[model samples]
Target: MGTWNEGAFDNDDASDFIDDLAEAPDWRTVIQMLDHVTKSAGYLEAPEGQMAVAAAAIVAAAVGDVAILPDDRRDLKAALGAPPQGAVALARSALARVVAPASELDELWQEGDDHDAWLTQIAALQTTLSASQ
Candidate 1:
């Protein structure tokens, strides 16, 4: 498919993206999804825009090793607009289950982390996440 564009489809909402991230069997899949969403949202330059905000929150959550803590998730999702839709109690269910390989990020990504290197990292994490399963 072509690169993502806003309003490309009726159900191309952030929730679907979020669910994709949560259901990603491995981090490689997660990065693929993130890259698609981020590229579509113009890297969140439209910070308050719906899709960008959602992608930003998920990136922050991943960098911060987020779990589905209700309070924290509430703040993240609300920042985008509203709350989760499914079973209220399971709002953060998928996120809560994420077990990152290491501690929270201490610094933002920078140069040297080129596209190829970044994909390599994602591939490695794919192995890690898959192995963990």
Candidate 2:
């Protein structure tokens, strides 16, 4: 039998590292993608369960991305053309949920720390509304 070395697959060359980093979606991109999905009629009509999963993934990714950024790097107040209260609160809430160290999927799901799941669900609804235009 061949020797099994777990670290063999873990070596990341520059290109590989870049590619991996590229695959890590940005919060803005995740939000945009979810917006697109929600706008699609097929997505809107998708079963509630499917929609929920997609929404959760988007929110989780967005929260995770934002959480890693320093306060100085975040400019949502200007970019969003709105006061920062809502966005800040939303980000804070989502970050709390996304950063939990729960090891099990169910535990993560049940934690509901930041209400990221709820925010995602709301986003999906907003997407549906926008798509109807």
Candidate 3:
């Protein structure tokens, strides 16, 4: 990374950007990726443990439904079925626990965005996580 010039304002930095976000990559990409994986016969048969969990986390985060375990999805829905809360309530609760807990994510929408900010945020979160744990 290059040192910022002293006059650099917010416009001069790409650190908080995710390049692809500038193009507004949509749910279609996330859905198609999931469709491809799930349509594969062996997709679910991937070995369990850390690797599987990690892959699932990636996919689930992309789809904005990370808190629901793959196998527990049905059970989760059933438990919430016909509850007092409405769909909006359910969605808000899920968002509160989204794997990507980012705000002003649109700030990540910069051309030539190196995504360094995301890496930095993840590192910080990991530190906070370890400290809490």
Q: Count clashing residue pairs per candidate.
A: 1, 0, 0
Q: Candidate 3: deviation at residue 117, Å?
A: 24
Q: Among all windows of ten consecutive residues in candidate 3, which has the lowest summed lDDT?
A: 6-15
- For residues 1-133, write the lDDT of model 3, one tens digit per residue: 2323211112212212212222443333323333443333331221111122222222333233333223423233333233222322322222222223232221232223644653443333333323322
Question: What's model 2's overall lDDT?
Answer: 0.32
Worst 10 residues of 2 by lDDT: 1-10
Task: Flag regions of model 3 displaced more than 4 Å.
Answer: 1-22, 42-133
Write one digit per residue (lDDT tens) for candidate 2, span 1-133.
0112111111122123223324553444324333443334432321222222333333333333333222442343223233222333333333333223331222423454633554454354344333323
TM-score of decoy 3? 0.21
- In the order shown, the candidates' Cα RMSDs to the true structure are 14.3, 13.4, 15.9
Candidate 1: deviation at residue 61, Å? 1.0
Model 2 vs. true fold: TM: 0.23
Residue 24 of model 2 has an lDDT of: 57
Clashing pairs in 1: 68-96
